[model samples]
Target chain A: MAEREINIEDITKIEGHANLLIKIENDELKEVRLGVHEGKRFFEKFMVGRSYKKIPEMAGRICGICTVAHEIAAARAVENALSVKVPECVEMARNMMLISSHIQSHLLHLCFLALPDYVGKDNSLEMDVETLKKIYKVKEAANRMTEIIGGRAVHPCDVVVGGFSREIGREDAERYGKLIKEAMPILEEIASVFLTLDYPDIRRQNNFASLYGDEFSLYRGMIKTSKYVFEEGEYEKYIEERSIDYSNANRVFVRGEDFMVGALARLNFNEIDGRAKEMMNEHGIKFPSNNSCHMNIAQALEMVYFAEKAMEIADEFNGCSERGEVKNENGEGVAIIEAPRGLLLHHYVIEKGKVRYANIITPTAMNLESMERDLRWHVEKILNRDDEEIKKEAEKLIRAYDPCISCSVHVARVV
Target chain B: MKIGVFSLTCCEGCSVQFLNIESDILKLVEKFDIKNFRLIKERNEMPVDIAFVEGFPSNDEEVEKLSYIRENSKILVSMGACASNAGIPGMVNYAGKKAKGIKEYVDVDYFLYGCPFSIDELMELISCIFHGKEFRNKNQNVCSECYLRGVDCLLDKHILCMGGVARAGCNAVCPYNGHECSACRGGYEGIDIKSHARLLLSKGFSEEEIIDAYEMYMHEYVEELKKWLKER
Candidate 1:
């Protein structure tokens, strides 16, 4: 029997660096190791001794992709610590900002990032000229929405500690509403395009986790699993994170087993409520999808759901006269917002009107275990393939999660 | 040529910027042999010709990785603000009341200056390496470029700008775009801290506000500014 050692020292096109090591014996994979070579940022250490007021600003620097989520989560946590109540209008605006992020980020991931994989393109640029144009249309719509609400697509600077530093006026709000309304048809079209792609036929029967509530929401939700739904505070009990020997990002398990979140999880949960069911059915995505590989389809479906949800949220604020405000001297706070990736939870301990301690749980961290599980499954199936084929499949498997490793402030794309 | 790219402690935007280059990236993929790139797919170990490293060395593990890359690669290029002046993560050094900084806290090598590393600049560096041209280490402040381009000084307008103290090569992006300098770019070499602070103070800004603004993002510089002020 012949033996070969296959190693990918760096994987590119994804965020952060990960090493893939596979030992092939007689063209069969014997052992596989997915090593995240980067070190973790000691954000927990950095948070100590800083005034609570600066938590949002400081934490916002964590990940450029999801800065708004961090900002809102940190600010909400601080407000809770100080026992302050934000105004209703302020809450609505905050919700609008967060929802806009979900719309922008999810669209980018579905069309620009993940779609290229299923379409057999290296990147969005490599897609067919016509398909590339459609992708750009979606990109433009996302960018327009992000600018109108978050102030920029990458790291939005509009969100401040107590609330938004600036408010979107009626005219701007109306313009934003118009943009979402105009983009809705395009978004649906993009979803339809995703429905046409040939997705990898892989499914997992693992548990699903996401923050679920009324009407396409990213903010204010309880942890909803296939088995149960619990309030935001109960996440600590349901989702467990353990430090792994190899990765800085902790492995997450729900009820003592690896679970999945983000697009697939959200879609699965939404299907139970008849949300986007027709679209799912139209796209041939069935609920209780056992294959994690189908996450790409879920991502596309969620894009349509998020766009419509954004339009509905914008319509509600269009005619509202008053915003929300919260005032409190000192108290603890916790905020959970579903980022484009998955559930993001921010907890703050405040004292003397300052943040004492902060705990931030990002979506990628929550999905790490699911990634490992999928990798194991993939490796098991493709162990007999050539090295190049094995490496290609491995990357596709990981990209399915759309892992945003930079959310923790310490990593970058894998190359 | 085999090239290795790594990140230490950063927002990872610099790497994202490289990915954002779109078509250019595919060309790069065809040109260079990637030996140890973690942002993409995993690969086997091979000899490296050039190493592009982003972010700051925040801990012992990072220290080891940096040393390994430096030892293995023929040329090492520090790729972003974090790798340069410790970036925002360096701000953590200002936590204590007494004077201790990130440099005193973490070990790093060489420097590339940008809040997020510029793809155009990186491409230039890579091209220079391909032609066997030595990459020049930037020793100038970001203000030089801002002044050379006749860009308006934010300090003159009572708006906060760190260009006076920040390292250069970004071409003053934030200031040129009508935004205040957030100092995502790291600090400069031979910065005249006293003069910069005094200039802001003379412009009707309060001392507390100046200190607050400076300390807000790059706290490591605050103690140095305080020491310089004390000497004055």
Candidate 2:
């Protein structure tokens, strides 16, 4: 019998600040805590009394990595409150911005952040020069797409409540279309490198939650969980959340159970492009995956699907379309979009012309419970290993979720 | 010289935006020994030559970390709006928990300002420090840069833009795209905010809207706006 105590004071190479603590007694895992110590930005409470037209701008500060996701979700939530229906072209424009976001986020995570671990390196900077260039080229192109469509890579100004303030001109559309086409092969090659990596073979069945739909869409969808499926309007009724004393982020549960969301969840529920199915086969992988490590592969495959979607939107581009006008009505709205990581929810209550209340639940916050559970399960198999090895494996499991700590701590349901 | 890039509690947009420098980032890696950037590297050595810190000290842990950065580094450059004037994270400042800037806690030598800050300025500052030259923070407002770029004045359209007072460095990207400047950067070297408010009020924009255009952020300009109203 042996006792072990492991504490990763700060996990490195991820988005924001986080730590892990574990206590083992008699060779059995007793206590494990995945602590999200990032300070609360209080976006939900600060947004109170702010004009509805500017929530997306404020919301964009939630997470720099997933800025577009917050902006789109906030805009959709604002639109829902006012009962404003945007045009098909406006939706198309938003969809393109989201797809571009997926490309850059996935590229950044897999290459700059997560790739080094899989490739037997400390970080991507330590990798060979040629590999870094290839990743840089692909990442740069993806970032350019996000910049072109969303106005800036980190916080977008073009994405507004009703629709984009600046119209997508024909020249911009053509340039965007060309960028997607040129970057396709390199992006696929980069995805192949990740998809074909040697990942830990740990598989377990758990509940999956994501935006429910058949089409390759991120802007609109229903809430789909393994046990139950519900519309975005019924989210709070189905998804139960309460804050714990230790972490600033609330623990989210579906039907009173910790569930997994993000890229893997969406792949299980949605219908991807036809070529993507072949891709999983090509890489000797399958959908509805149970392993957490497979989340990386899911993200890689998603990059390909999103690029094609971006191309389709680009080809369909004709001219500047009309944006929806805000009515300044009083109501409540909830928007659920499949962010690059997984399900992103932005809910708002509008009274007069200002935001009366806001409740935002990010992908990382939803994945926290599952992460702690998986850390326990992961540590159990490697209990005999030393402290450093156990720490690395646990971090890999958490990193596989691509958890954005800032997003999780960015908002809370405060009255 | 060793380089360290640290983040406290922010969107980490400034750090993320650093990588968005695209190809120049690769060249940067070859030029500088960036040993302590947690966003890209895992192995980090301390007591560096230049330390660029984003986000403000919102809690005790962050405040402790800031002091450590100041103590360990030779040149401490407070990067972005959060570290400079408590950017979006400053929203908590209004709730009575003031998120103070880095300069409030530590003796900062150079300051790089922007919402996500300016990567161009960051790169320029690094070379200046590396080459033993002085780095001067941009003092012009976004309106000046907007005029230079020929971006249409949103004020002419009755849009309550903060470009007239917001610091320049982001090249007026938001205004050029037809969006108003939300003042992610702190105010430029200022003389008169009262007259600007007067102009905005004359343009039929409500005083409240103009104030919120700056997002009521914790900055000197918003206070000036409030005090001007009080004097009136």
TM-scores for every predicted model: 0.76, 0.97
For candidate 2 chain B, which ten residues in a row score worst on lDDT?
B213-222
- Candidate 2: where are CA atoms >4 Å away? A413-415, B94-96
lDDT of each: 0.65, 0.84
- RMSD, candidate 2, Å: 1.6
- The digit string of per-residue lDDT tens for model 1 on A75-100 reads 77777666565666667666767766
**lDDT for each residue of candidate 1 in B1-232, tens digit (9 for 90 to 100):** 8877666656666654554454455567678866665554233364577777777665566667677777787777776666666655665542232222224443433345565666567777778777877766566777787888787777777766667776677776556544456666556657776887888778887666667557644666788777766676
- Candidate 1 docks at the CAPRI level of acceptable
List, in order, the clash count of every candidate structure: 68, 2
Once model 2 is optimally superposed onto the true structure by TM-score, how far is the C-alpha of residue A252 displaced, in angstroms?
0.3
| Best candidate (score: DockQ) | 2
lDDT of 2 by residue, A163-257 (tens): 88787776777788899899888888888888888887667647999887666578887788889989998987888887888787889998798
- The true-versus-predicted C-alpha distance at residue B21 of model 1, in Å, is 7.3
> TM-score of chain A for each candidate?
0.89, 0.97
